[model samples]
Target: MTAEGKILPIVIHGDPVLHNRASEVEEINDDIRQLVADMHVTQEAARGVGLAAPQVGAGLRIFTWEFEHTGDAPTKGEVLNPVLTLLGKVSQEDPDPDSETEGCLSVPALGYPLKRSAHVRLQGFDVDGKLIDFEAHDWFARILQHEFDHLNATLYVNRLNPRWSKRWKKELRKQGWTTAGNTWMPGDDEDPFGHDAEAANEAEES
Candidate 1:
């Protein structure tokens, strides 16, 4: 892999690439390795724990993750064409908003609660085609599930409870995000979750 990778623009929620299942990577090659490298860079640039290939406009089954809040040492790696196994039953009830909240880079600025399995196992190939088998729990498991869903053309918002899902759709419409071609550059664009200082002050005064 190259020592450095370029940051790629992130596609938004309405992009067709995000809605279509990604094709498996048939061969591990320099290009695939480069894409993995760039995905890591993009994930970090967006301050996200994980990112999928489709989020970057590539219709390939791949994802990269770097998270340090799993109550253990930081976990970081890339998985290609992953197969996920849930270790425990996922609760069907609405998730607790305080603890189960999730945010997606594609959705930008929004967060909502969604239920997910607490334990999971993922098997996949690394960038070099080596086998990768591991288990994840807590937030790490959530991250894995979130990225895996991307490979299957599902987003977290799509998995939200009906109430939250409707709200999310309304927000998407308000922001004009229901069509394709929306994108954001990491370093060049305004912070996705950053609040405008003036707006904040005005709200506070009001």
Candidate 2:
């Protein structure tokens, strides 16, 4: 949730900002600082791992994830901003390739199996701008890719194989996907933010 305690709205498939590249964050100013904190609170409240600024309707290169919080949030957590993330030098060959199922807060109900590097070393800072480093394997590396995609206006949906894509379409339709092109519908899951569930309702109505 945001500082106002209203849950931050999530920009889903049809949102324009989710398709265009995000702007680079120029300064770690108070607004940017507040963004990281807001993303953390919002993501936790939404039960998400990592969230980018674009997901929250900001067209800037800011995202937050907790290396420590695998599933729980606020319970034990540190919210990070990528501005100071070092993403250390791990050569292409240094990390092994692995595939795993992945999902997004932006595209709920449709998770697809995708490949990613098995390990990573990242340097960044928490919401307070305190320096932090993240060394992770498997799922954690996947988290890095997921969060980074938000900066580039990419979604895990783009990574789905043809087989997975077909399966996703069928299932998402069952979950109420109405947009004919590249779009997704909110599943039966609870949406803390009103937009997704409302979108789902609208899709079904039309």
Candidate 3:
């Protein structure tokens, strides 16, 4: 699994693994370090800013992130069993269901307008089992929240505005998605993203 072409594939929205609460990592051993490294490789392949353990079909509370945000270089690292504390006031800008939104590697084609706390304080450990704590803002903060959601078995789709949510459900139905328990699964659709790729591209540019 450490070799090229062995990178784990990202589990999609309909996958049951994405809907279950991930178990906390009890220790940071060789296996987890490899998993983290593999996740980074997988995220890079998918062109994603962040990726969670569950997204790779692992029920572990861990995630990897790499994105540029006003620092010496792109903030890159892995957080195991992270705990996030949101800070600062909520932005006054209302969510525009079809505007600049966040997309997920699991839910390939759709982007959803979501409002999240502008700043967050994260407390977690690194691969060495050392304590790692920091405060994040703006895009970094958003990334933290997004990946954190995955640890709780939630997706960005769960944060979509009512209008966009309705539309998303409609599109799922059109794609033949059926609800079972707490999650929806796509059926026979080759391209789950469909037309949402354009919107997702726009979001990336901004």
Report lDDT (CA) for all predictions. Answer: 0.90, 0.63, 0.77
- Name the candidate that leads on TM-score: 1
Clash totals, every prediction: 0, 3, 1
Sort by lDDT, top down from the best = 1, 3, 2
Cand. 3 Cα-lDDT: 0.77
- Candidate 3 per-residue lDDT, tens place, 50-160, comes to 989998889999998998887432399889999999897766576855644888877776777888887888889987788878888887888999999999989988877
RMSD of each: 4.0, 8.4, 5.6
lDDT score for candidate 1 against the true structure: 0.90
Across residues 1-206, which tens digit of lDDT does each residue of candidate 1 receive? 36468899999998899999999999988888889989999988887899999999999999999987544433888998899999988998879999999999999999999999999999998887888898889889999999999999999999888899899989988999889999998878976877445457899999
* Predicted model with the maximum lDDT: 1
> Can you list the residue pairs that collide in candidate 1?
none
TM-score to true structure, per model: 0.91, 0.66, 0.80
